[model samples]
Target: MKTALIALTTATFVGTAAFAAVADLDSDGDGVVSFTEMLASYPTLTEEGFSAIDTNGDGVVDEEEMTAATEGGLIPEA
Candidate 1:
């Protein structure tokens, strides 16, 4: 049990770090990630791919959307 817990904690930390790495690309820190910011981290991101991940049609990808996209493999893992 202890080993499992430790593994889980490590995984969580790794995932959080990856998320933060991507979030840090938000150069403007506007709480939403713009296409330019996304592209900074993912040079291969296309207009269609970004639009698909934006989901809400808000022209920016929020944390929730980014999480979903990463988990769903729509975007490369950070």
Candidate 2:
């Protein structure tokens, strides 16, 4: 029974993490995600919204930022 409880807890944690990661991608907490939606969620984003998504500020949002935006959450990951 202890083992089963542990397993259940572990699964719940993993599921929560996964959901959070995906939620990060949804800047507005909406089901859909898009560059426009991201910009709208973060009004402070500069006219060039891409730059804001580029957390590294490398002038480009590499896989990391893309993942953060689409799966890991928003660039800022707030």
Candidate 3:
């Protein structure tokens, strides 16, 4: 049971790490990343680039969008 618990804890961290890029960007912990938040990590980011990452054009980037952009090489992994 102890070993299983350890494994579960590690697994959870590893999974969360997949979104570590946004984790650092979303300073408000609102579960969504905004343009200003993205700029902090990607200094060279432009409005066009941000729009591309925003995907749904909702004016914010979420975990799924962050993952896609990273996996697609649109943004660097954090």
Candidate 4:
């Protein structure tokens, strides 16, 4: 029973980590992740999608915006 519980816990942790990795916005394999990269990688992003990512409303995506977008899970996985 203890072994089973440990296995379940380990599985849950691994699953969570995998999901987090998938949700990460750094899809381009580049050191600096951005919403533009996300859009390029996932072409399904529309104007609304861009708007959702441009948290600062500067009309351009920066690192902070990208980080926010990534943390918010607004960008899709690579």
Per residue, candidate 4 scores C-alpha lDDT tens digits across 1-78 of 999999999867755654454346456554343546556667787778878877777665655556566667886655
Q: Candidate 2 lDDT, tens digit per residue, 1-78?
A: 999999999867766654554465466555434555555555555546565556676553444455555454344422
lDDT of each: 0.81, 0.55, 0.80, 0.64
Which pairs of residues collide in candidate 2? 24-73, 24-74, 25-73, 68-73
- After best superposition, candidate 4 residue 31: deviation in angstroms? 12
Model 1's TM-score against the true structure: 0.70
TM-score to native of every candidate shown: 0.70, 0.38, 0.71, 0.48
Candidate 1 residue-wise lDDT, 1-78, digit = tens: 999999999868767755685568779867678988888878888999999999999898877777778778898544
Ranked candidates, highest lDDT first: 1, 3, 4, 2
Instruction: List ranges where model 2 is wrong by over 4 Å.
Output: 32-78
Error of 2 at 76 (Å): 18
What is the Å distance of residue 31 in model 1 from its true position?
1.1
> How displaced is residue 52 in candidate 1, in Å?
0.8
**Residue 8 in model 4: shift from native, Å?**
30
